[model samples]
Target: MTVLEQTGRRPAALAGLWGGLALTSGVALTATSGWLIVRAAERPVILTLLTAIVGVRAFGMARPLFRHLERLRSHDSALADLATARTEVYAALIPLTPARLGRRSRSAVLAGVVDDLTDVVESHVRVRVPVLSAGVAALFAILLTGALEPGAGVLVATWSALVVLLARWGLALEREAQPLLGAARAEVSRAAELVARHTPRLQAIGAAGDVLTRLDAAHTGLARALRTQSRGRALVTGGVLVLTGVTTVVMAVIAGRAELPSAVTALLVVVPAALADTVLPFADAVRAQARAEQSRAGVETLLDQTAAVADVGRGRQSSTAPHLRLEGVSAGWVEGRVDVGPVDLDLAPGRRVGVVGANGSGKSTLLAVLARALDPASGRYLVDGRDVTELAADAVRELLAVVDDEPHVFAADLRANLALAQPDASDQDLVDALRVCGLESWFDALPDGLGTRIGSGGRGVSGGERARLALTRAVLSRRPVILLDEPVAHLDHATATSVMRDVWAATSGRTVVVVSHRHEGLDAVDQVIDLTPTRKD
Candidate 1:
């Protein structure tokens, strides 16, 4: 379902009401100011003009006042909707987490989701409220003009229709540009993120120039898309002004022929000019609508994916340490493309296994299947001799602690960061875990020790430190089974070897599986599984 459909109606209604009032006030202000000026020009008595003077002042004041309220109501409603939509989207993504998200560049896909949600929710404020407000103001304009003269009313309605048509044309243009704009933006984000996260490595390997060239190309594409999208808004903006100028002249001519009073004629001529603010926003609203539609489509498509693994029931929860086994297991991340294994594996309690393969050999895919993030397509995956498919997914997940390469370090205190893995762990327990993962020196160097803030906007951590921190978290969790997917990939050979030594020491009695393309950490494993493709024929 679209984010707009899920938003609360009451707030939307309140926003519309305030918006309508604000727009109506603007129209009234323009019309009254014109009438007051023309009446004064007639050399009427001051008392005769008092009512018009008061109306002009009232409308001028009410316009800003109502507009302020409209902004408050609309923004508040949009923010509330944003919060709810984010919560729902996060929940919906749990089952599809690592597997269905994609094999590579998952961070970019997830980032796109975040951006899309913001656009979808902002539609209420940018498109819906403005459209409603403009509609109300237009209706008031038509009714008031009709009360004065039916012919003028007909002219106003016709002008309003033309404005709508212009808006529709703009919307069509924006809709055509939306996909290109969205794709360009996503590409830019992915390329920028890659460069930002791995600049040093790229430079060391002499690929920095190549990566930067790609980033420039992505930025250029994004700029082109944005320029294309803006053409629609430009057309509508110019159209509205031209239409308003023409309508004002037509109204002036109509009033002259009708022999209306000078004040009434002035009001009629000013009506079109007054409505310009109301109709001009239609261009922006159309663009917003197009963006929201594109965003909604992406969000819905991702959320619509069938989970990689389904929860059968709340199956058996292991009371003691769990034993896992994969029999003739072949798992594919995307349907119809087998990425990993048609091999047998057994892990009794406390066994350490290392999985090694070159790129595309599916070492990570095998780890994913073991982590139960992906279900095996053609094999029996059993935990404690019970099929994992029969057991509750959460129950199986509870037995494993996973540390992947890009482990997030939240912008929080060192204690809070470690506490996420084991919320009930004591500070001393955290320190112990950190020490075991070879972060003892780093922890000691912290100005506030466990209380020191880290992650973004805090103390800078090195790549090796980040890897160790992730291992610390896994050690703190103390789950029986630990899955490490290149947890030490970012570190140098010596550091990777040292971290693996610490890993073996810390997870001494736990069932563990480490997946890496590098051989640096293989020495600590009880057994190594090589997934390099071999010709059978």
Candidate 2:
């Protein structure tokens, strides 16, 4: 089910019911207390005042009790919806990974999805409950006041109608600001992640200052967007208070000229002020309503995209790696544009090929096509002499393992991290894979051996070590075909050569296709294809 489809509507509706009761209780408390004060001051009989005092007590206690129940139900519903949305969105994104996520890093894309989903689910409590609660309480106030004094009732109804209009205006302002705020926040996040992930590279190239300047600019834009958003909320909340003051004044005049009892007149005067409390929360609801709309649009835009590669093809199974060939194959991330081109290549089993290209030469694009993450736009890609389009993409992908420049290390122990590639492998098998990836010495030196914690909060890893760890996983997979896309790009010359040496040794009998702009690892490959673009002029 889509995220919007599982919004826990029933629970939110129940919460709104409870919330309405709580707000109505609060309004009743205010009106009753006012009535009791006025009636007691008139020196009424003690028994008459006793009932008013008891009513005041009852409503005061009911407000808190109902409010507590409302909170419990509303929050529970939001949490339940959030859980389902996260699970479904994650599952839906799996097929689109690496290719359909656009040019953003996977971490950034996933982070955006997480934040958007939270916003969408939060609407149940922030938007639905508040609007429904206010609506119910306002309707009750209008009826009660109209019964006692029709003129006062008209004033209350007008005030409520104006409040609804004001909420619509507030929502429009919020919608205007949301896009700016979202873009600014995303820029801040992107800039921050770049600095955090590539601090050493930035410092090494003396570009740290420039990047920091860009980060500062991003923050400035975010602060500006926040100010813009706050202005809208301020206008809305301030308008609610001003309207309440006017309504209360008009209500007093109506009650004063009416033929009602002193106690009833006081109740009419206090009604508008009491309802103000409930209406004030609408400002927050307006903002949330606007935010949820934008978030849902973003998520739908992403999830609704047709995948770059087709899924329905003949279900051909392969017992071993098939001979792959790209006959004048070309592909691109966008339609009507070719990023990489008219290249010819052949990969018989166990043959190692290297693709060398300058930046923008589409080396990665070709590798994506080879890995079945992307479909060729023109020409043919063949597996075992059969057109690749005729075979299931997943079946073709099963024989290959890809290691890219950016390999993530989970916050886990050494054994757990490496074991994901081969879940049933023993400790000895893990150690062997580490040895094959040239990480045996590093493993032995670890403080806790295979038990050592790594990533985020644990022991830090050098770039070379991180690359080797990824290699270890690829080696352990035993997929028969390895595709390395600049796996050692971030490492220094010596480390890159050493890692490539281990890579060659570990995959001796496996077909390998390595793409890199650098010459550090190409010597080990059987053949190299250079794709330096020529100037048309």
Candidate 3:
């Protein structure tokens, strides 16, 4: 369903208010126009006063229209709200992430958000403007027929018919774009994600150029589709408008020659032109609604996917690691390679546990289970003897701060990195965490201290440095548990050992689980959980 339909309150409100106000204004304008035409015959000076009054009132009304549009379009708060919802939806879908988004889906979303959503905003305004303006024009035209002559009602009806036809065309266009745009957006976004995750691999294989070429081509395809749609609409509108203009001209000619009162003649002539102008806006409204529908689908689809995992995690909180247990947990990768546990394990707070496994072993997955990143296909995972499977997701997330092997660094500055754990963190806390990560030396060399950009893919920083930064982020998060996929994977012996020591010491009071093939760096853990072949088999 469209967002407007979902709300159910806004459409009627917007249509009723805008259309009613417009209709009311039209009645007022028609009365004034009739009066002006009548007076213009006997009191020629009255025409000047009437014209001045109309001009001022019309000018004054523009502000309300503009203000209403301002609320609907490009409001900073509205944009921010949309952005947040987008982020939330994105976060929720991290679990069921498909391998790749389809091509058609990608185009749909890009078309929807950047194009369709924007159109919806414009459509809303167009819908209102035309409704208001046409109502006013029609009122005047109808009034003029009785007071002035019969041609006015006929002219008004013709204008309304033209409007109805165009509005129908616009709605049709949007409805068609909805699914196509949805599919395209999903594809494009998925492609973007693929590039982002595999940039290093792409570069290693000298394939970045090729990838970009593909993305560019896809983008071009989306743009072409949008342009074609726009051109078709413009052509339809232009043709109708030509017809409308001809009708308007004919009305003016009849008004001039007719023997009706001057007031009536003026009303008959001017009403068609105003009515035509009002109806034309419906074209824009139709296009806008189409765009909104697609944008709404992109966002709402993402939103609708609020992970059952997040919901499942929303039940309990616990204090210790051993209090955390895994019971018969079985899950698949890429859809069916059952990897670990119908094996049991328990951990307690302040315990340091190491998970060592060969490549493709379930070590990383085990850590995720403990960290509450993945929900097991079946079996129970518990926190503090309470089914963590039942705990609130936010609570579970807050409790475990994970730094996986492929840690994701935000596109933010050095200090901002550690501060994400606690947005309101004091300078001292940041310093303390960085010191514990052995990153004080790196921080000291930066010109901007805490404000240097990390660049894309941590381009400005080394892998080891990025790893340390991730650890720092977790430490700053100040959670009860820390899950490290492989905290010291690529560091030199001394650096790796030191980073491990510092990390272990900083997280001394929390539950720590490190998944690694090599174990030299994490001797501080209380116990090691090995998912290595011999141990598991």
- For each candidate in turn, the TM-score is 0.93, 0.89, 0.72
Arranged by TM-score, best first: 1, 2, 3
Query: lDDT per residue, candidate 2, 1-537, as tens digits?
Result: 355866878898999999999999999999999998998889978998888889989999998999999999999889988988999899888778777888787987898899889889999999889888888899999999999988887899999999988888888889999999999998998899989989999999999999999999999999999998887688779999999999988888888888678889999999999999998988888888888899899998889988888877877856596898999998988888899998899999999999998999999999999999888999999989888778888889888999998888999999999999999999999999999889988998999999999998999999999989998999899898899999888888999899889889888999999999788878888999987788898
- On TM-score, the leading prediction is 1
Runs in model 3 deviating more than 4 A are 1-147, 181-220, 253-258, 261-267, 310-322, 333-340, 356-364, 390-395, 405-417, 445-462, 486-498, 516-537
The residue pairs that clash in candidate 2, if any, are: none
In model 3, how many backbone clashes occur? 39
Task: Report the Cα RMSD per candidate.
Answer: 2.6, 3.1, 5.9
- Tens-digit per-residue lDDT, 126-226, candidate 3: 55445554555566556655356566567666666766676676577667765665566555666687698799999999999988877777677677667
> At residue 334, what lDDT does model 1 achieve?
88
In model 2, what lDDT does residue 169 have?
88
| Model 3 per-residue lDDT at 310 | 43
Q: Provide the global lDDT of candidate 1 against the true structure.
A: 0.88
